[model samples]
Target: MLKLELPAKYEALRQRVRAFVDELLIPIENASTAGTDLKPEIRARLEDEAKKRDLWMLHVPPEFGGQAGDMFSKIVIWQELGRSIAIPPRRWAVFGPDPGPILYQLAEHQREKYLWPVLRGEKKVAFAQTEPGAGADPAGMSTTAVRDGDHYVINGRKRFIGFGDEADFIQVVALTDPAKRARGGISSFLVDTDTPGFRVVRQLETMMIDRPVELEFVNVRVPAENLIGREGDGFRLAQSWITEGRLARHGARGAGVIERCLELGVAYANERTTFGSKLADRQSIQFMLVDMYQHLYQLRLMLYDTARRFDAGEDIRTESYLCKYFGDESAFHAADRCMQIHGAIGLTTDYPIETFWKQARSFVITEGPTEVMKMVVARKVFEDFTKTA
Candidate 1:
């Protein structure tokens, strides 16, 4: 049986998180952030506040001085955090260092050198996989890593890597066996930022206000021991990271965005007067609000179900694709409708609607585009449904 409702404890935790966002994050939502991150003073204060509430290190493991939060719990927290634009959608560290799950696959020695430093906030890591020709598909990647006696010489260019300029090391994905490609030829390597041939080419400007960097690796020799897992695990490893991201970041955050849009839209529609009556009184405005509410309801159910299944150790690759595209598209539509309802005020910085609109709009293309997600899901649909035929 599938349970959509959260457990008592989780529901309680969700309330706590929502309260934190409404009281703390929402009030400062309009304040200027420091380059996609919270300002030092603001971050310091919030960190202290979060610690006081025992809200710190929500995603980290218990052994690493974190709460070892579960998947559902993380989705709840992320959903609440999505309500405010004060926290950058992509780069956020106030909750503590999130080395990400891919690092957990590092070998014992690699863990000490890379993962431990990250857990201790002594280091940061950036994942490099996207290239000029590759965005969603890794089979077309052009980056190559040639194995030598003691090291692998990497040559590739990675684009749109978030926080690449500030990282201490990079989890670089390269073609280890050209014949296998994404099937079994790709490999992941940990390369130090100061390594001889590693260079950050430039920061790519984006409408989302987060500047992701482009990186160039020319004959970057990474020690053989730096390879994560086996030589042919790069594509799988990267996809695993991206898969969970679609669920937690895209799916959960989309639910939160829809909820927030509904909140803002309903409040304004009820209060703001139009040509003659309150915006809420207009059928056109009501229809948009209804649509936003419908998306929120559907997305929440799907996110909860998918997250629950994932927590139970189920493989949700196809479900994740469904959640990702539906969530991203829903949130964007909700934001667009909310903006329309708010009229010109929505576009101004006076309201968070504009930022929400922009962020939601960008999500439709970033993680996995809607069309790609739909294509993946369509394949699964045919696989499952045609089996009965």
Candidate 2:
């Protein structure tokens, strides 16, 4: 298990981010909620301010111009950012530069070309692993990359790519050899958005907080050098990336939604009155609030425990599945109860509670569906017990 010894500098970093959000991000989000777009100039200005405050790319390694934050520290930062209505954009600006699955298997030139630019905020990256036909079973993907001289010509369509419209580069998975399938036939490539034949088919507007896109690669050509790692290691690399990413999502984002639900519930209980008495005084409301608190407490402990284990270099696939399942279920339940407590106002866009409820619902399907996670848990349990027996 990972220990929770906070470095002396952790508190200072936390305070800096909290102050930045309070003074800058909250105002921008409020304007956005009023149907005003955060103009590019305004975003740039805030980005400059954030950079000046040394708050950029806190999640990446220090060598990559990041603060090299640990899992626990990232949990703190993400939770603080989650309190605001504009968390998606603000958090993206601060931590978006960090490399994902591609980093683990980056070629030398690829790292300098793609990873470095991301860390410096000069470029944005997105992963294109999912397709319309390959939602859960990635190996079932039909996206093909055929070798042509010194380059590979990729032709396929990827859907629901998060932040795809604004990404400077995308890491794509393709079948190099269908005979081996995922065993040694899958390959990954770094494709520049400006490359010929690469096009954004459409921007997909979802119920969640972020905007995703569908991309079409019509004979997109990537040089051999753009390939990441060995030709057949893409599946393994993707698994590692998703396992770590899912943990972060469950630990940080899920925890944040739960905390926000509790906050809104508490505030509502104090202000709203029913039957000539304050809602806080009602036994039913009190019981619901207590339930929300209990859920949050249990989820946080599980999240932190899993995160600590991950940071300690332990294999946490099973734990991550458990975290993802419980995290989504707990947050959704809390958000539902919160909405029930708020009555009609909860359904309206007038408050952030409605938005939180939508985001929680998305969590149930995003990283891995709740059903898939449970299956993973059962499989792991069966394997472990069988070994002991």
Candidate 3:
């Protein structure tokens, strides 16, 4: 048996985070945070508030000066934070440092050099995996890492990497063996951004607020010691990072979008009048609200159930894929309906609906798109059911 309901403590934590977002985040979302990043002074104040509220470093481990929260608790925080567009969809670092999950896999020395600096906010890092020719398919990666006497000479081009230009170092994934590719040929390395041949080519602007970058690594020699885990561990490690990301970033955040959209849609429907009646009284408007509510409820259930099973030390990778596609589609559809319900205001920046709409739409395409996710799930479906038949 699995538990889907959040425990008492987690429920209480959710309410606290919800209050923090409602009081501090939502109030300043439109005014204080217009861009992808919060202003310096505003970020300082919010970090101070987060510390006071015990919301600081909720994801990092306790030994690393963080609260060391479980997946479920972290999801609770993520879902509530999603309620406000004030927190940028791409960058959610208000509470504390976000060193990312990959760093936690680092060895002791690697942690001292990379992970610790990141947790202490002394350094910033970015993951470089998506190549121009291999956005969704890692097996088609053209980037190659050739092992030399004591270093690996990397030659590759990566695109759509967030914070690539600003990062002090990067977690780079490359093909070490063309024959193995994503199987056993791939490897991940911690490369200093200033390494001789590493360059930030340019930043690509998107409809979304995030401006991801393109990078080139030509004969960039990284010390063999910088290799994360074993040589062939790159694909496995990247999958681990992505699985959790799909859970928290897509699954939990999408829930936040649905919850917020439902709130906005219902309020507007009840308040706005057209002709001789409130929009809430009309069946069409009511149906939209109902759909939003339905998506919210279903997403929350999937998110909670997946998080619960994940916390139990079970392999929930497939479930994470389900959460990714379903959450992305459901959230996008909910945003669409919310915008439709808002009439013209939804298209304007007056409400957060437009922001939600654009960001939610992007989720369906990025981070293993809906089609790829469905393909993975379809493989599992055939494997599990066809064998039984």
Candidate 4:
């Protein structure tokens, strides 16, 4: 039988993280810096506080000098951190590094130089897989990395790279063996931003605060040692890493949004009124609260169940898609309805409901679009059908 209740140890950890998010972080969130990160001084102080409270690096493993908590622990941390915009503690000091799976495939010597720094928060990196023409399909990438003696000469453009401007280097996914393409033909190379031919061409303006950018590479030379995983394994490495991201970022994040929306909506319903009675007294308003709560409840169950299975080494890729698809829709619709219940005040920046609404909608498209999510689930369904047939 599977354990449904969090152990005392996990519960204690959860409470600590919840206190940090609610008492410490939420207060800071109301400031002008709300949704933006905390101020430098405040961030340092809070990070120090988190470290002292033994609430840091829950996502990392003991091998990396981290708590090396189980996948469920990491999911719990993400759920809490997802409550706010300032997440992963920037330095990954509190949440551990999100360096792509390929980094873990690096040779020990190469890891010492590239991987350790990221884990230590001394550096940041971006994965360059999508091009102007290759948004969903990695096989269609036109970027090429031709080997020239000791280095691979990379020539390509990567679009919509989040935080690319600030990244120390980019893991450029390039075609090393065109004949194979997605079939063990693509490769990933960590190209330094300071390289002569590598540059951030421009930062693409976005509705969200963070500005993703386009990176241009004109014959950028990447050292042989910088190759991550093996040559012609780029697509495989990318798919492996993106699976975790879809679950953690999109799936877990959607549930967290519901949690926040419920907090705001319920509070408003209890305190605010149009006439002589509280909004909570109105059946319509109460129904909205119930619906949002229901979504949160269901999403939380799905997320936790999925996290538990994942930790137990079960294949949960299909479930990950389902969780994200359902979670995104539930959270977005709930937030939209809550905003409608709040009247005009909800439209203002003073209220987080509008932000939640906007972000929730965007969440559907990120990681994988809603359509793609359904496609993945369908693929799984048909695979099972064929097996039985």
Candidate 5:
């Protein structure tokens, strides 16, 4: 009974993002495949072009020079960007730096200093909440920050931090009081990447395209003004940001991967031959294609429904988990089917399907593991049922 319709404005936005990806980002990503790192020169060139087109930071608020899109609009745009193996659209990288918990908690001066520069792409920031010891449980983080007269000295290690090495600012969570834990002991801080004692100990090469970093903080000093929100709201704020981000990743990026997989499958089916006939003529191939289509359609509907609910200001904590679970699983199914249709070529780098497969597999673990997401959904369902009973 869920309505699957998109507003005309959002549809148009989708097309715009799709066009940019097809025309610009795709080529850049194609060129960067052999190189382990995204070339700074190439990135600068593409970012410049994106800015010229007013496509700089699509998710940031308009007051900060971004489009200020709603959740629905973001879902549509990010889905289109995720359709290719290329560098994500310029805005995608800016997502973490944009409006979320950070923006809402920014002091007036802090907003003007850090947030605005970030929106303009003059500075880059990355989330650094995950640690070597703390994967899913932020409450167990060992990172500690003790307040000094004018600054807070931090000491800890963070791992699997996305874009951490390249970021100018790092958003980190540390324990200020172990007794309060997640309730009132944890705090979030924005630390300059160049601050003394903050170092990139190692870079983790993920199965996916981006290489995140493992950072070491040795008595890193951060101004007291760098604290985001209240001293103890770090865990709550982090949870909200992470939950929303997980939904976006699953719904939008997963949809894009599914679409790309279908494209690869269909292209192969039409031309690939076996037993003197095209693969498209084979009943087995046709069935697989149909099944893939079913999964894609189902995922798309769920993504839109969840996005709409989020935009309507509904509490989507449980729905977000459902979408993440379904979106990742469905996309993996589509990618596997598409690779099967391509035979050996799909396994090779000659086509993008192999990369897509790897990326999809990584999604099954990122944000939250698939098993963890399912448990969250189950708990929510049980709680709701008990309340009604």
Candidate 6:
């Protein structure tokens, strides 16, 4: 019941995205990117070009004025875009709102005011959940939002939120009942950035070029209408988003990086001479190349299988974690091997391998760390093992 090949319907679009990334983006990436930031003119022009090809808004539903590329199609396109170090998270987000699926829970008027504008790139929204002390432990959060008649008074500190520094508003998760925590007391709220008492504490810079930030909420009052879904649905809703991200965010990106590393490594080995012979002739380098290829081969099967299951509407929590965990580990391994092939040259920015290595390192820690992913996998294993016992 698994479709391993690219679906026929998406083949054209896949190739188009692939060509755009390989021929256009990668070739000009070094020149166009000022350090880690893409030049404004280049970003604008690329978006405009994607628009001309009708390639924008690939993930939204058709009813929402999007092309409605399913989970499988997203995998296909992102793998290609991921091969390029220069492309941002959303490759086809040129013309509209590429807000994650979280916005689907918005009310009609809320969508009109918040979601639609974001899909159009007219506004940006950030998700706030990880607290100052609660990175992987969502249930350990201390932020609280108490109801105050017409509005909820929120006070909390959220750390390492991507896009928080630039977003017009934020989707926040708060503890309404400390006794229940993630069980039945947590809630989601949308708070505008300019709301009194809401403040950006600082931008957190890492080896990653695009910096994320921390935010402090001091008695920030949000209207009752700003609540997403019903109270206590926060953790449930956030789980869906997090689980989905386990596949798309680091998984797909890692797969692309793996593929690129192998490509560059093989080419360099064949062309470079070492110790009076082609580097490819050395067994040490040959074994690494072979191992890299095998890893990608197996990764492709796992990636497509998991994606097919997701599109078929199956519960993929365990499978997604496994895929993401493998991706996080395997990508860095592949990059390190490739860099070994490139020797010291790979350590410098003159080559993209250095950046790829850092990005792969970053992937291991983002979304959910490999350790958390392993925890999810272990839970599923124990549950299945004990079934009917």
Those runs of model 5 whose alpha carbons end farther than 4 Å from true positions after fitting are 1-4, 26-29, 33-37, 88-91, 94-101, 387-389
Candidate 4 structure lDDT: 0.76
Q: For candidate 1, which ten residues in a row score worst on lDDT?
A: 1-10
Estimated TM-score per prediction? 0.97, 0.89, 0.97, 0.91, 0.90, 0.95
Candidate order (TM-score): 3, 1, 6, 4, 5, 2
Q: Which stretches of candidate 1 lie over 4 Å from their true place?
A: 1-4, 387-389
What is the C-alpha lDDT profile of model 5 across 340-377, one tens digit per residue?
99999889888877777887887877778789888889
Model 6: per-residue lDDT, tens digit, 267-332?
899999977999999999999988877777777788788888988999888888887878778888
- The runs of at least 3 residues in candidate 3 whose Cα sits more than 4 Å from the true structure, single-residue gaps closed, are 1-5, 387-389
TM-score of candidate 1 against the unseen true structure: 0.97
lDDT of 4 by residue, 1-389 (tens): 12346778777777888888887766665452433344567667776887888766666666766775466776676667667644422222343456655677778988887889988889888878888888766689999999999899998888988778888988788999999999989998888889999888898765655567898999888888888878988888887677767666666767777777777888888889788999989999888878877777777788888888988999988988888788888878878987988889988877777767777777777666788889879988888887652
Candidate 5 residue pairs in backbone clash: none
Could you give candidate 3's per-residue lDDT for residues 67-136 as a string of tens digits?
8556887789889988888877778888888987789989998999999889888999999999999988
Q: How close to the true structure is residue 138 of candidate 5, measured as C-alpha lDDT?
A: 64
- Give the TM-score (vs. native) of candidate 3: 0.97
Q: Which candidate leads the pack in lDDT? A: 3
lDDT of 2: 0.76
Residue 28: error of model 4 in Å? 1.1
* Model 6 regions more than 4 Å off: 1-4, 89-92, 387-389
Candidate 5: residue 88 Cα off by (Å)? 5.2
lDDT of all the models against the reference?
Answer: 0.87, 0.76, 0.89, 0.76, 0.78, 0.81
Residue-by-residue lDDT tens digits, candidate 1, 209-272: 7899999999998999999999999989999889878987899898889888888999999999
Off by over 4 Å in 4: 1-4, 32-37, 86-100, 386-389
What stretches of model 2 exceed 4 Å from their correct place? 1-12, 26-28, 33-38, 89-91, 387-389
Q: Which 10 successive residues of model 2 have the least lDDT summed? A: 30-39
